[model samples]
Target chain A: MKLVRIFFKAVTMELSRRMAYKADFIIRCFILVINSIISPIFALILYTTTPGIPGWKFEEFILFQGTLIFVFGFTHAFFWQLLSFTIYEVRKGSFDRFLLLPYKPLSYLTASSIETDGFSEMFTGIIIIWWAFKKLGLSIFSANFILYIYLVFLALVFHYSLNIITASFSLIFIRSWALMDILSSLVIFAKYPASIYHIGMVFFFTFIFPIAISAHYPVQALLSAVSYKLILFLTLSVSLFFYLSISLWNFGLKKYKSAGG
Target chain B: MKKYRELTKIGAKIALAYKFDFIVSIFTVPISIIVFYFLWKTIYAYSGLDVIRGYTFEEMVNYFIMSMVIALLGWSNIERVVEYDVLYGEMVLRLLSPVTYLASLFYTEMGLKAMSLLVEATPIFLIGIVFFKAKVFSILNLILYAIAVLFSIGLVFLISFLIGLSSFWLKRISGISRSKKLFLSFLGGGFVPLTFFPKIFQQISEWLPFQYIRYVPINIYLGKYSTFLALEMIGRQIIWIILLYIIAKILWNRAIRKFCGVGV
Candidate 1:
């Protein structure tokens, strides 16, 4: 609860700082919104040209893309700055400042760093999801909606864990920004329907890495196509992943011999 | 030219210094190819068609590979560099240098891309050849492709330099650069082939200089155009390059005046 309050306060401060550069902020957000919509737009173009990823209609695919974008936007807004700043500070041997702070280093770092463009991406995702739901005649007040929300929450947890794990690498490697690109390559597999990938990839995305938790299963929950067994497994896996990430952060922190300036 | 050559060497050395980062980045291209391969493979199988929009599954994969190549070749971050220098007052230091600013940037970018060609693009091209049997090795096609790519590099540099020049007026050009990048990738057929675009977009793209950036070069490599037609496309690229060079010069003179007037 305290951490959440800190996160909100930091977010408010960051928002005000961004608003100080009104033109730049607005233009950056507008560009980000456009960037966020590219995947959905690509899906639309594909669907119009040919049958896109079997067993999925245009609107369904749009929803899946929207869900991925929303999850990405959420992570980008709240956690991505933590990863980059960790790398930057570690590289400059200035990361010990976090340790000197009153709060837990990871929690405080995560709370403080916020990106303004992410809100625009999140807004674009919401618009896309709403448009798709309208086109599909789906209601937002159903049991499925509750399940979708739960899964999306898990997805957020999954991304937060991933960010922590990646940021922890910076403590050890000192220049680990390239690790984020690998995460991007892995996470992109979830941008489309899992049916399009090989069965092995689908299994890997669901159980092992579980990037599909960010989009695929959440969309399935909304479509009422998800299985209880998969949800049970996702819940366990995401919990384990989060545990691993925190454990890794502790390990990296212990291993840290600060590059003292 | 001698100073520019020295600058290029320095740029290449800087890229080499980031070799570890480049190695990790190499993983990205293959993963992108894998995703495109599976997605298109499923699309073709479900549609029960051998070809859609003049692309077989193999051809489509090859198109993506060539698109990646063209993208690497044409990539420029001069706008961002310019933005930084302008906003941070580093432009004054760069102005003390002997070589022209944009020329120095162009050569440096070329050197960076040249090294990346060896580190990144070559391996991806090889993967296309070995795995997808991408037939992009015809002599005539290769010649035209090289010429077109040269023009593409110039065209991209001028466009980015012009965007950077706008910083003198706007004070910040990150949004412009980002928008230009996203728009170029989409409209230049980097994301999808122009053949798959709607009729109106296809017609609109024909008139845009962007198509020459990725689409025309890749298509020439794919032998989608005859030798005469490929040469004609290269001619169009040269015209765009010349026109853009003119515009960039005009913009640069005005931007310098603005900078001087403001005492920046």
Candidate 2:
């Protein structure tokens, strides 16, 4: 309870600091809205040019894209600072302050930075998802929909694990920012159906990287036919990725030079 | 002229010192290429051998590969410098220099990126041409394509300049800069061909300036337009460049005045 209170206090302080920059914050929110609007325009172009991209209809693609934007907004809202934690802290030699704190470094790092712009994208994403669902003729209240939501939670864990793994690399290399950018761009692939690729590559995405699980599998579970084995594989992959990321993070922390100390 | 050349040489040397960054950026090209390859490949598979948006599967792949290369070559890191100067108050020192800060920074950064482009493109070009059996243009076409590419680079530089200059007003412009880059990639046909866009979008994109940087050059290289049409397109690009350049200058003057007034 005390730890939770401390985390909340840190989060509140960060939010207040973010709020102080009102103009910049509002501009960023507008940028996010523009970004959300533009993504669907591209997807619309694709859908119009080609009938359907293998295993995904026009509405299905919209759902995938909308869900992706939605989930990304959620992650960015809560943990956007994780993306820059290493670079900011290392440059300021403030990372040592995190180490000095009683709480886990990851939790502290996450709590200390919040981007309110993400809330704008998250709001837009929810609207897009609802529109996509209506277009696709999916039953929103079905028992199967609940199972799909569960899988989405699993996928979020897997997605967060990939980010944690990559961010952990910051301890060894200061230039991990560029690598993170590349990785984030690669995540765009998950916004489409995995069946578009070869089965081997799909397997690679699901197991090796887990991006397929991020959007492809859960959406498939919700709207298309999927096997129990695939679900089990996805759950196992999420657990394995989370474990590896945590272990790698611990390993990287030991090698951290921490700018000053 | 001599001073600019010397500064360019120095910039190239500094870029060479960061060999790892140069190498890692090369990896970025293949990732984009593979993603588009799969995307268009999927489209082709579903549609069968019919041409969509005037591009066959193979042709679309070639177009995107070239677009990716051109976009990489035309890439600008001016925002980093802008953010640095704005946050650290280094703009004051830069303002004191005899040279126009934007022009000097532009030439130096462009020269550095041009040199890095050669290093990055050599391997990709070789593999793309020799292994992939990608189509090559005639010698004259290649030269014309090079001119178009230089124009595209100028257009991108101006855009980046505007984004960077906005930092004078906004404390943090990275999000805005990123959003602009993303917008360009989608709307400018960096991710997919602009030809595939709806007619309304296609017409709109033609006027947007972003399309001139990526789509116009690549389309010209792909022989999508005749020589007369290509020249007209290049003229349009030049117009956008001049317009953006003027806007950037006005913004710079006002932003600096504000900065001086506030003493931030």
Compose the digit string of candidate 2's lDDT tens values, residues A1-261.
665676678667766776666766677778888888777887887777787687777788888878778778877776657757766666566777778988888876766556676788889888888998888788878866877788878877876777777778776675555666666777767766787777898879988778887677778888866788878888888898899998998987898887732
**The 10-residue segment with the lowest total lDDT in model 2 chain A:** A172-181
How does chain A of every candidate compare to the true chain A by TM-score?
0.94, 0.90
Query: After superposition, which runs of candidate 2 have C-alpha atoms over 4 Å from their true positions?
Result: A87-94, A173-175, A257-261, B83-88, B130-133, B167-172, B250-263
Docking class of 2: medium
The 10-residue segment of model 1 chain A with minimum total lDDT is: A17-26
- Poorest 10 consecutive residues by lDDT, candidate 1 chain B: B255-264
What is candidate 1's lDDT per residue for A39-154, written digit by digit as tens? 88899799999988888889999999888888899998989889888888888888889999889999899878898778888888999999999999999889899899999999
Best model per lDDT: 1
* Whole-model lDDT values for every prediction: 0.85, 0.76
- Chain A alone, model 1, TM-score? 0.94
lDDT measured at residue B5 in model 1 versus the true structure, 0 to 100: 86
Indicate the fraction of true inter-chain contacts that candidate 2 also forms: 0.56
DockQ of 2: 0.50
